[model samples]
Target chain A: MSIIIDEKTKLAVSGLTGREGSFHGLRNKAYGTDLVAGVTPGKGGQDVEGTPVFDTIKEAVDEAGANTSMIFVPARFAAPAINEAIDSGVETVIAITEGIPVLDMLATYWKAKEAGVRLIGPNCPGVLSPGKANVGIIPDSFFDPGPIGVVSKSGTLTYQIGNELKQAGTGNSSIVGIGGDPIVGSDFIDILKLYEADPDTELIVMVGEIGGDAEERAAEFIAAEITKPVVAYIAGFTAPPGKQMGHAGAIISGSSGTAQAKKDALEAKGVRVGESPTETAAIAVETLRG
Target chain B: MDLLEYQGKQLFAKHGIAVPSGEVADNVDDAIAAAERIGYPCAIKAQVLIGGRGKAGGVKIAKDVDEARQYASDIIGMDITGPHGEGPFRVDSVWIEGGSDIAEEYYASIILDRGEKKLLAMVSAQGGMDIEAVASANPADLTKVHIDPTKPFDAAAARSIVESAGLAEDALDEAADVLAKLAEVAREEDATLIEVNPLIVTADRNVVALDAKVTIDGNSLFRHEDLAEIADTVDDPQEQMAKEKGLTYVKLDGNVGILANGAGLCMSTLDVVAQAGGAPANFLDAGGGSKAEAIVNALEVIKSDSKVTAILFNIFGGITRCDEIAKGIVTASGQIDLDLPLVVRLDGTNFEEGLAILAEANLPNLHQEKTMLDAARRVVELAGGAS
Candidate 1:
């Protein structure tokens, strides 16, 4: 079985009437995800191409049997949307909005934890279980059902590796984008645990970048708990200290979060860290073959 | 954004935290005048974002009018290099504050703990030194408490932290009060970091913040309009230009210019370029909307950098269509006086249509590669040798 999402997952779109929401929500529906409902506070009873739209997540859950939520609300309203999903009894909430405040995320994260709900992202591409369900914004064309489980902080980097794996005649069991913010709902360990538990996931590909101790911490967790062979790609090896390299969480602060330190940590744990995306894909393929 | 010392103090005072009275002066005369108004034996501190101002002689104590004038003049135009050798940032202003007689020095700060998903409050008796150094050298001297944002942070909680940090008994109550107020500033002002490096207990046993290092959350600045006004401006011309164009760009020291559709992709592109024996000049994320105009703007920003000899476009079309990116590249080539060789690698989501658009245009300076690795190597080769 796939991790996090599968054919039985029923989805609801949180900001289904908006531009990005409608665009990606409809696309996910077209890709055969069980996109059963939509939530847009004042736009209740409106239909997004036959998917029932409700005023709240509770209505979507009650009326349309939505088990999961894909939130495309604006940054300011994104956290509240996640909380509403948790309160409404949705099992999982995937936030695709960017620029969410860290404080708001902290509160939402605690709430989700207490409620036993899985939260995916605040500034991420979301999760894709190939040929089964497409929950967030990961491009549907780059994936297929296979042995590798992909977990990354970068959306495009995830897609790049997915494409590389597909071109090499391999595929992904699930591709989870945990987001690029300083405070996200899920971290590397959270997804790694799921991948390791999934029967279909034979190998794991982790794409990490600079900033934060998440990668270093994940290294320790992998060394202790993970028995699956993990191939990783960490960006920003040549990045200068103190400069925020695109992503909010991708910065080499002082000497702590340098790419070299992350690479070293992962390598010490027996995880093969690639210098580039293509090379990482090759290493994963080789590991699977071996 | 990191606030200047005076700005941090102002934010602290607004939140009921005690800070020494200070005035910000952009000129030497105003600094001297402010020092006189505040009384003698005032501290004239350089108002630059970087640290180590005191070590660079950017900080001085003035007892008399003559000394105030001399110190202000010395600091006003001083070029202090950043601790990381980043810059010789010129000090444009001085913060003159009334001096206080210190009884003891301690440290207190509130920062986001990503791992724990809580607001981390650290209090240490070993103050007036780098907190990292303190944590590394004497780990027990620093006491860290994680506060759940969902829960209330009260005076008793602050007092417990202060007491646990091993501050002197006399300074405990006042220090606790300061810590409580500091936490308020962190929560209310959306500050990612609120650090009082030397939270001092004065000779009269009053706790006051001697130095304030506050960094407001950039994402939350929309709610804090006043704080947004004081946000730091980009110093590099290329960075400022990229900001104006609404592109996520970071200026790096290299020759091959790199542009891509997402932050991760841009960073990975930089890594790939480096692996291919080329140094990336900058990291530019054109983002999801890689329209023709956005492409022109991104190309202009990358081309403006003199070090860039070649440009690489690594686009993995997810939400962004490769055809749109191709149109952008073709349109950008025509819009600007294109001189550098551009290696375009387009994949996924209508990539063939995108490649066809570029091939139909057949721009002489443009080259196409099917794979990211091939494209990176091609651009690096054209940009001379690797770093």
Candidate 2:
């Protein structure tokens, strides 16, 4: 009953011959995801521990029936890899690579949208549907199938919340890391919509940070559409204005993208917003119990 | 990644976009010489990244050599605080340009619109005024067009945008040409923002960019080697050190030094520290899969800040294993004479082993917490309480 990915999710690994690609791709395969294909141009026919490698996403889709792609190519080539995934008719593309130029994402995103393909990240930890399947680098040890659905911009923060919830004797339906870039393929509202329609996901945990009006906009959408109880956490409350705090999208530009502003927006929409990751998990736990 | 006005103009000129004729001068004498060469009644503008230089008295019109010398001297050393209260940034250089005969003023820019997932072209006939204000006051005056980056924004497309924004008919053709060039600059130069605030029309009906506000995408800077050189160097010593060490660090006004593995966790660590009655001295993301060396480097950078009395390491292991982070902490304790109180919180992958490693090392100054909240509380208390 998990959203986005499940036991039937056939996966392809882009840049599979590379270091990160092989590491996580093999790991995901070990975790029982249907690892059907590998994509690394010029490395065709080369297999990573028995997984078939192809030169292009099209071959992977055609020969191996790969519906989803996990991209670990370098930033310079990540965008093209994403576009190739879309063009190949893969239903979903998850890019684990960081630092792809914004302009590249703009074009790839437009293409993905037009083609009706779901693209996950450029600088994210990827998604995991516990016990059934794991994609990207989200630790396999963190969860068991349960009622809560998690979506976040921050990878580590998502892990922290998942750990906290697990400690409270709860588990997750799915954990989606939408990435921490200014222009990501998927955003908070996009995942929230999925969670709302999922039968297994009773409550949602959203983790957001400063910069951009995404969270504020998500709050508006949640108020209108999401009937599921949502517990949220926003980072960078103490951040100074005009300073970029680690993530490209995490910055307080003037007074617009402050954590306080985001918190207020979410709270006004009846979403329980936590001051910290631990508190966020507690709120989600309490909501589920209710 | 924000370029100064002169640098932006240089980029614009390189992309075939029209900008006022100018020379950059670092001192008064060169400014006067450059002004004389350009002709009298030129503008001496401060070359600072922050906006509102004109309001800050960082810009002046010089009629002759004496005026040029006076204006240049006044602006070169002037400190301009931005309209947004960004900075009192010191002006190190001045861009002296031949004054334009402004028959009409319009606004044009090409920027990445995150919500739209497209390049947004905003044009307005009401230029020389704040675009935000224009959008709010007279929304129709601000013509907003979302251009797909996959498709070309040629002269024809640009002309339609200019005409729709209600630019003067005579200036439309020339403005469209400049807009098209600006669009090329946005695409080719990998500029996240290319703003010509007052795209001016001269008496001769020539379209010229009076100002350029260009922000090149920092991630794409690797491809743009020449443009990368124009990036503002980190002024903070600790920040510069972190940059060299390949650690993501930002200096903040606080005393409790913070370190975490991910950007979100790092920011949350800061917020938790503040909530726990502590002010975080800085934000440092050790990044995923951090090794012992990165731990030592981050510790050294934090200790270098005399304001830091306590440091917290919040690691929620995903790809970043806790044992590796634990080894890093133990190694950092031995390498640096860390007199400040250190609090470490390890969770997720291999956390028990990581905790066992930290406990075995038994560093006297180090304290281990079971959770991020508890860690923040302990660090704040050890750092002498509420900031």
Candidate 3:
């Protein structure tokens, strides 16, 4: 069984009438995901790429049997869309919209937690369960069902690291791109817990970068609880201190959020921190093979 | 982006946070005049974006017009270097504000906590000093509380945090009020960090924010038009150009010009180059779905750094088509004449198509690598990184 979503998962995409929403919404269907419904306030009863649209998330859930939600709403409307998904009783919500305000995310996160909803991202490429299911925008073409579980803090890095693993003949159980914002729904530990519990995932590859203490905290959790062999790669080792590299979350403030600090933390927990993506994949492949 | 002190104060004032009456002046005469209007015994502060202005002799208390003129003259052209060598921050303007009798100083801030995934409200009764210094010396002096991510920011929580920090009974209510309002500013203004280093309890029993440090989140700028208007100010030429082109570009000190599709990958690309024994010239994210024009624009920016001996394009196409990036590279090759070598590595959807497009062009000095490591090694070698 895959984590997050699977073949039985039914999806309702909010903002399905918009440009990026329609584009990736169609792509999700083409990948054979159970794209059952769409949500657009004024454009209800319309269709995007043959998916039936509803005026609200509640309607999408009630009428179309949608159990999962993918929100492609713009940043300005993202918080409300996330709230709608949680309130509508969807078990899992993935926010694909980038540029959401941290404060807005905070409010939505509290509501989601109270409702016992699993929220993936507000600035991420969502989740891909290899051939079984695809949610959000992580390209399914790069994935194949296997034993490795891939989780990353950045979307492009997920693709990059996923490609490296695939080339090494190790397919993934599931892949989660957790987004590149200062505040996001899920962190490293959240996915790590899911991967640790999954029978299909024999090993894990955690891709993190400079910024935040998520990776450091993950390392601590991994040491205490995770029995699976995990390899990690953190970006921005050469990045200067006290500057934002690219991602809103990828920054080094003082001595706290440096790549070196993260690498050291992971290493202290018996996790191999690769100097490069290629090296990280090699370690995972080696560990599995041995 | 980090706002200047005066700009931060303006934002504070806009949010109903009490600040001393002040005006920014670009010249000594204007500073003196502004000080005269604000009343005597005022503070003349350099409007440098970098911190440590007080330590750099960029700040002085002036009791009269002569002192204001003298302080303004000394501060206007002062060069301040912040810790970790951030500056040589040149002072171009000065803020002359009415002075206050500080009965007590407190520190307060609201910021997004990455690890907790919540808004953090931190307050300390020990103020009139750098928070970092306070953190190192007496960590217990700073009281931090978390605000819920899925609910409106809790002013009550901030108030309690400030109250617990052990303020004088007379100053407690106003200090708590200031902390609460600061949390609101963090919510309403879409700020990543709002810091008041010296939230003063004045001699006359008034709570006034004597210093403000605000960092508005660039990602949330679209919703807050007012914050958007105050962003960046086009301080650096390349930065302004990148802003217009929608590229995430940060100039750095190195020679291997690097470009990648996403932020994480972009940063990883820089690290990989360094690992391969080469320094990156700049951090450039071509962004998702980047076309030929975007590549050309990025190349132009990289070209401005003459230290760049080679370039590397690390694209892992998801929503971003590799073939589009290939065409972009080809188009860029034709439009811009580059003497330096470039190594392109493409993977994911349409990767073969992307490779075919690049092979068709076979531009001069262009190399293709099958793996990221090979690509990095190739560019670094060409960059004179190989031993």
> By the TM-score metric, which is better: model 2 or model 3?
2
Candidate 1: which stretches are off by over 4 Å?
B84-88, B385-387
Q: List the residue pairs that clash in candidate 3.
A: A106-B149, A106-B150, A107-B149, A107-B150, A107-B151, A108-B150, A110-B150
Which 10-residue span in candidate 3 chain B carries the lowest summed lDDT? B149-158
Query: Model 3, chain A: how large is the TM-score?
Result: 0.98
Query: What is residue A284's positional error in candidate 2, in angstroms?
Result: 0.8
Query: In model 3 chain A, which range of ten residues has the least summed lDDT?
Result: A240-249
Number of the candidate with higher TM-score, 1 or 3: 1
Task: Write the residue-wise lDDT of candidate 1 on B180-288 in tens digits.
Answer: 8888988898887888989999999899999998878788988998887785366689988988898888888889998999998888888888888999999899997
* Per-residue lDDT of model 1, residues A1-290, tens digit only: 78888999999999999998999999998999999999999999899899989999999999999999999999888888889999998899999999888888888898899999999988999999999999999998988889999999999889999998998999999999999998888899999999899999999999999899899999999999999999999988878776777777886657888889999999999999987898899999999999
- Provide the clash count, candidate 2: 0
Lowest-sum lDDT 10-residue window in model 1 chain A:
A245-254
| Candidate with the greatest DockQ versus the true structure | 2
Q: After TM-score superposition, what is the CA distance of residue B154 in candidate 1 from its true location, in Å?
A: 1.5
Model 3: per-residue lDDT, tens digit, B1-387? 778888888888887889998999999889988998998899999988676789889889998888988999999988998765775767889998988999899988888887776778888989898889898899899988887554554445555676788877887767777777887787788888888889898889898999988888877788777778877476667777787887888877788999999988888888888878888888999988888899999988888777788899998888889999989888888888977898899987789999999898878888999878889889998888532
**Model 2 DockQ, alpha carbons vs. true complex:** 0.82
Cα lDDT, model 1, residue B177: 86
